[model samples]
Target: MTPFVIVAPAGAGRVRLLRTGDDGLPFTGPDGSGLFGAAAAVTVEGSDLARTVAVLEQAHPRWVWDDTSRWYPSLLAAGVRVERCVDLRLSHAILRHSTLTQDSELAMSLPGVFTSVAQVGVPAPASAASIHTPAPHSTLFDDLDDLDELAPSSSAGFGATDPRHSDRIPRVNGTGGTGDTDGPELDAVTDETPELAGRDHSTEDPEPDTLEIAEFRRQRDAIRTATDPSRIALLVAAESAGSLVAAEMQHAGLPWSAALHDDLLTRLLGPRPPAPGIRPARLEELLASIRTLLDDPTVNPDSPAELVKSLRRAGLNVSSTRSWELKNVDHPAIPPLLEYKKLARLLTANGWNWVDTWVREGRFHPNYIPGGVVTGRWASEGGGALQLPKQVRSAVVADPGWKLVVADAAQLEPRILAALAGDRAMAAAGRDRDLYDGIVASGAVDTRAHAKVGMLGAMYGGTTGESGRMLPRLARAYPAAIKFVEDAARVGEAGAVVTTRLGRTSPRPSDAWQDVQDEAGADNATEAARSRARSAARSWGRFTRNFVVQGTAAEWALCWISAIRRRLWLLDASTLAPTARGGAAPTAPTTPTAPATDLRLEQRPHLAFFLHDEVMVHTPAHLAEAVAEELRDAAREAGRLIFGDAPVQFPVTVAIVDSYDQAK
Candidate 1:
């Protein structure tokens, strides 16, 4: 029979086939070139056919077209194995070998490997053939136990391959006879495997260590348990009236203009509509069904099977597979529940019945959350009603005779870029002015629009290859900004998870990733394909780098909230007065005719709404100016709190408007 030779790329270094010939030859030469050179002359031994076929099947071509680190473990789980993996580490290396040669087989076989590996479990081997072995021939299985130990920790650092391992290979001498002897040298490689071993892969860094995580889990558990009774009540109520409200809303075309608070009150007080009169009865049935479902202690709350069973009992034709599909529809209980949620939010914002007590003179207070978006943005809850639509800003009337004052940050993210990149060119453009104008001044691109697209693409990891060719020029113009992204990409590719400022770590890569990386070799097209996938994975890491910045911005917003709250308390009672429309006056005096009463800052300015990089505060008409000043100071303090006083300026745009839209 014809001998089947496994020919690896020239730069693959030392190729080791899993199966050996009768003479025990893993490869004809170190680079596998001799195998191809004698391709037509060699003949296979019939006795070794099964083993040879098995080895070929197991070592089917794999591609690390991108980064292979992340998919390594999944490849293992899927039962796909790679005999050779390649790590062409540099783009120049890829371009250099683009021409056809004896090494060209590696490129020719790549497409097939990608297709086969993707279809079946097997992946092509990666090329790291440059690493010297202990002997003339080494079967991979001989080193399995020791290689397992080295695989986990070996991939750390900036380079794609393990620098330490790459360095040690060429220095070692073979334990077996010299390569000139024509028999199997497998034992020599096997003997050296143990010598090369370092740390145990299984025992490396155990997780679940942080105290804060433990505390968070404890708090989460407590909240879950404490809310159980309320949950049950909500469930029962939702099951009962939910369908009727949904049906009514669907039929009546419930006007969106109606205040949620009013609609909820009406539902609670009015009679049931005729079309869905049986909805109340249906709720009881659903609750009974839930009880029956839970009676089975083995049923898991999170299980789709259990949920499907409960739904079936409630007369819904649902199954585990169909549960996701059912959620999009307007279930009967949905409208009423949504209405309740809206009312609840309104009551929470207005201080519930305590509105009369909490509203000092005629003003309500609110709270603000910064760094809330995980992207350096702010949010508001309760009286921070700035979240409301612009059309409803009229609802936030000033005190008897005062105006509403609002302020927000503009082009916040770009300024963040300037600070982070420390790009003198970009900073100079933003100096004492707008960021877009600075890009316009650079002349790297024709207009701010092109510059904007390029800058955004660089930050977000868009426009690679041709579409991104302009990036290098941009980077040259603003080297600091380019370096910031480059460093972030490097950190991401290395598998070091990035996190937000408040300790929100990016999720760790899964096992599949390790398997893919384990398969990458300098000569293996399969490994090359896997490498491509790994590069894609780093995109999320890049996003997280920006997330830290965005999230910090959110923290700053909260600080501003706290600051504005402080100044609002200093306002006198005369500043607050009820208007004829049941609203407060537009502007009034800071002091009233009556004696002064001491008030806490906490009791004054209320947070009404929050949007990314912006905040809205509600204060008495007389204290609008005070609140505006407080807003400015808070913004400055927030900047100082995050980036420190490195001469970074965060200017806020303030406005006193009667409507929310006008403020924006």
Candidate 2:
């Protein structure tokens, strides 16, 4: 078997496979070549793709593919699982923006191509307008003028043209500075195959898979030239592994309880009131009590404007219907009104209709968008996976005979700070205990609350109130740790980039921020412009400050989850058969998609849920202890992989429970 087999799209939704040399360089053409080797193609014709892939899977070759999420799902549906893959999309984003690869011209010339599928077509998150990530790898997509028009032949400096040149490799000018070579043309990659994120390439403006080979090569070259090659390599690999894990977690749907969900909702919201888009009985009763107390039955508590008007008319002198503001008015309506609004939000957000739409067949298959947040935290596209209401956790019960082994890193950020800064005092403080308590023990703050607030203020750029007061004490106690964020804040305030420990970079300030700064500097600038500039600078600084810790924490999490994922695969497969479906109560009617095989999820341990800092693995009762052990071992391994012998700990709170609520 070859060292690497690239599974890339050929054209029109068809895929082709090419074998690379022992060095992992892709094939040059169709027939076996001295540079790259033999090739095979597979069109998406019914089950043929899966069968072909399954044959390839037996070789245990490292699959070099585009975005793992986009391509792997179909293969999974076909029940084909590969050993490993190189996610060009995810890796491209990392290398393009990393501080370590700033000298690589590939990061500069190739901009605007690394947009994820979620970023395309769908309405982008508000953060997208302000945050910009790295460039795209031109391997599996077409249509960019910068990437089109030429192939990267041996004469172009990848490998020599000699037939006996198996040892021939690209020459990279490392140690001194970047070489002045017109880096390999991206469009010149194999065929017209284009791999993209989430979905197939758009025909109207296809980004052909021309530069994939070159891009992958350039990335490898960039890493070779990076200051910290091992860390960057591990970070990239773990991120790719994370992509695979994310896809699998989504594919293996979490067992949801439609009946229990209905019961919980019914008990809380009074039987899902008969009228559509109407408040429940309990909520309606609260609203009635609120209106009567305010002496305004016509108030319409649902509308802030009407509620405020009625409150003012009642002489309560409230400026708004916000609970805090209303509470200050000494009104009898405030308490019940707040309660009503709280329950009303749950009913509207995660009520019966929401359950019906998202929770299908006893599984809530949320679309997990990895690296979705600017700080590298994941965001859910549908089903509000990240925001599962505590009220509805009973719905997340594991299949019977299975248990949930949930583990969450405790004080992850602060511990990361200690390791990143090499702050021995701070590390010692957090040795075997809560970081906040450690800070208090070290006499940095008066209480645990103050310590936590101070740390939050430091990381989040809070410079007023209690945080402001405690900041000085924290700085005095742990200058190295505080200085890490302070330095990041300064760099961000200067409109520069700050990278996480593993090279995921914080985006540079937006152009609008620069314009505001320039306006503030100009003689004709108004106070508004100056105020805006200051605010913008401060906001960006806070983002960068947290970006270092949060982004690194995210990296740690990726490593943790990926480690767990790999370990779980090593365990013996359970022989238990699939169980019957449940979840058709009148209030909660769902038809969960049953297991496709005899491998019952309850019998074999698998990751069912992952929110930042925490994860829940569903496993048979017999394997619960092993899963918990793997979770801890993974946490320790993540710390070692990221920090490499740093004495700081990233301990996780572990619990084995029948339900998610029990774990908490």
Candidate 3:
């Protein structure tokens, strides 16, 4: 078994696998001798790809590939799960933008396909505009119409909704989408094979095997030469592992009860409207009450501009229809208006249409985009997996013979701040209790509320009101932690960059931001211009201050989940069998495609859902306690990995429940 196996598309319906030596680099050794050995490489037919990979996986070699999403799903569908992978695409994104690696050729080079895929939604800084081309405007089809609720009239007029289309076929990990053209091919070679990120590389000098190998080696060199090589390397590994977890979670899908969803919707929103462009019965009733109270029967509640006009006409001192602002107004229509908005949100965001579109085969298979957010948090592509409102959470049910083991880190970001800053005082305060309460116990503030507000203000640049007043005391008690963020904020104000604990750097302010500062310094500049510059600087400062903490917290989360993944793999398979504890026989749920073995996912506990700090595992009933322990152990391991032996504790609140809402 080799240390590394490079998987590259050989052609349509076929792939080439190159085995690397202990150095994880094929055909490269210190003495300039080829390291590919006797079995250099093999071209496997698409039909044999899964079996070949499964065989190789037994050795526990780290697999290297262009993109995890493009390859892992097919393997999972074929009942093949690899333990570890080096996702070049995800790693490229982190290394290319990291301050520690900025001097490396990979980071200094102009943006290309790799950059486009890694930084899909990232806006190009002014200095790089000429060299970087933005990718197509990608959006989540799941929440595509949520924006329409408030879009201007010309954009999507009253009652306008997303174009009606057939339900999206379930393609775990976006494997069947346009961007997934390079996914598994089980037939003969097609005329052409798409390159990374769905681009054609026919005109390039080297074949995909050469290109992939080259890019990977470039990344490796960059990381090796990085200022903080050790931390950067760990960050890269954790991030790539996150990609695998994201793909697998999507493949397993969140256990969903469509029937329960419909019941909840019907109770809250009335029966689904009989036809398109019609409101649910309850929503229509709320709308009627709102119109009559405001003496505008025709006013459209969905239109923000019109709703405000009606409210003003009805003698309510209101500037907008926002729920928070409406709550402050003393008016007869306010109650009904707020109720209408709540119901309207549910109807549009997760109504019958959402249930029909996202849920299939008793599961909600969302497209998870790992490292999509600049802070290293994940973003979903199609389904609104991140925003599973408590209103609809009850519908996320575990299978009869299984259980949902949900655990979330308590006060994750603050604990991350404590660890990153090495503020022993702050770390001591949060030792084994709620962080806010710990702060209060340390005499940082009189109440838990003030402690929380003060800490949030310290991290988020909150310098006014209650948070502002508490900041002084907090700073006095924990100067190290406060100064850490204050330094980041100051650097950002001066248009500098701040790096997270693991080397993820913050993007510089845009050209417009620099121009404002320049204008403020000119002889002809007005006080207004100077004020604008100050405001911009502070805004960006606030961003950078939180960036360091939030970004590092995301890193901690990645490490935590990665640990959980590895630990779960090591659990005894016998314990995961549903009938091991005399639980009812399991039922096989329908999948998009017939898998080689239907029970592969159920063979052990697997992560079914993950948000910023919370995770849910779908496991056999018999293994619930074991899985919960694994989650706890993973949290502790993640802390040790990122902030070695830091006195900071990352506590996880665990719940074993039959459904998601119950966990909460």
Could you give candidate 2's per-residue lDDT for residues 281-340 as a string of tens digits? 898789789878977779787788987788788887777777677666666778888888
Best by lDDT: 3
| Reference-based TM-score of each model | 0.42, 0.79, 0.83
lDDT digits (tens) for residues 1-664 of candidate 1: 1121222221223211222221112223233322222111122233332332233332222121111222222333332322222221211122112111112222233332222221222112111101111111221111111111121112211111221112111111122211112433322222123322331121212132222222222222221222121211111111112112112112211112123333442343332224432233333334344445435333222346765665555565654524245655345632432343333344444322333333333333333332223232433445443355343344444433434566778567656655554456766766666666667777776676667767777767766753286677688787866666566555556554443222222333445754554555335657566766576557555664455345434434444543443334334554544323234543545444333332211224444444555656655555777778877876765554334433446778988765445666
Q: Which regions of candidate 2 fall more than 4 Å away from where they truly are?
A: 21-24, 27-46, 116-211, 316-329, 524-529, 574-603
Question: What is the C-alpha local distance difference test score of candidate 1?
Answer: 0.38
Question: Stretches of candidate 1 above 4 Å error?
Answer: 1-402, 464-470, 499-507, 510-532, 570-590, 593-603
C-alpha lDDT (0 to 100) for residue 326 of candidate 2: 64
lDDT of 3 by residue, 1-664 (tens): 2346778888787787765542345532233212122334556677777877765554455678999999999999887887677888888888888766778878877777677743532322211000001111211111111111222111211110111111111111211111113322212112232211222212212333466777777887786666645556667778888998998998888989999999999999888788878998988888888888788888799999988888788888788888899899987878888888988888888888888898888889999999889889999987789988899999999887789999999999888877666678988898889999999998889999899888999999999999999999998988878877887788789887677777677787888999999999999999999999999999999998898889989988998898788778766664333332224433443221322223476456889999999999988776788899999988987776565546779999999999999997
lDDT per model, in order? 0.38, 0.66, 0.72
Give the candidate order by descending TM-score: 3, 2, 1
Clash count, predicted structure 1: 105
